[model samples]
Target: MRVKVDADKCEGHNRCCALAPELFDVDDYGTATALNDGNVPPELEEKAKLAVQNCPEYAIEFVKD
Candidate 1:
């Protein structure tokens, strides 16, 4: 599975970054972006799901690979 962050929907909450630093990165302005072009490693899939659930803005989404 892969993940994508919607820049327009994101509110800079950074929950994804805090929960899954391996998969996300927060910018100086606090906007969170997916790492590795939103590609999720096998081991980090669960963490990605967790981040998705925790995002209040619902800006994170799973992408079919």
Candidate 2:
């Protein structure tokens, strides 16, 4: 599974990082950055999807490969 973040659509929400810190990181300014270039480990795939689902700004997306 792969996760994608639309920085342009992000609203500085840290939910993604909060949900899965290993998979996502929040900058000092509160923007989110993907730690794995969209590649998520199988164990963390669910959390990644949860992060995408919980993003208030609808900035995160998950793609299955």
What alpha-carbon RMSD in Å does predicted model 1 have with respect to the real structure?
A: 0.7
* Candidate 2 weakest ten by summed lDDT: 27-36
Per-residue lDDT, model 2, residue 6, is: 91
Give the per-residue lDDT of model 2 (tens digit) for 1-65: 88988999988879999999999988888889889688998899789989999999999997767
lDDT against the true structure, per candidate, is 0.93, 0.89
Candidate 2: where are CA atoms >4 Å away? none
Best by lDDT: 1
Give the poorly placed runs of model 1, Cα more than 4 Å off.
none
Between which residue pairs do clashes occur in model 2?
none
Q: Candidate 1 lDDT, tens digit per residue, 1-65?
A: 88999988899998999999999998888888899999998999899999999999999999997
Q: Which ten residues in a row have the lowest lDDT in candidate 1?
A: 26-35
Residue 36 displacement in candidate 1 (angstroms): 0.4
Look at candidate 1 and give me any clashing residue pairs. Answer: none
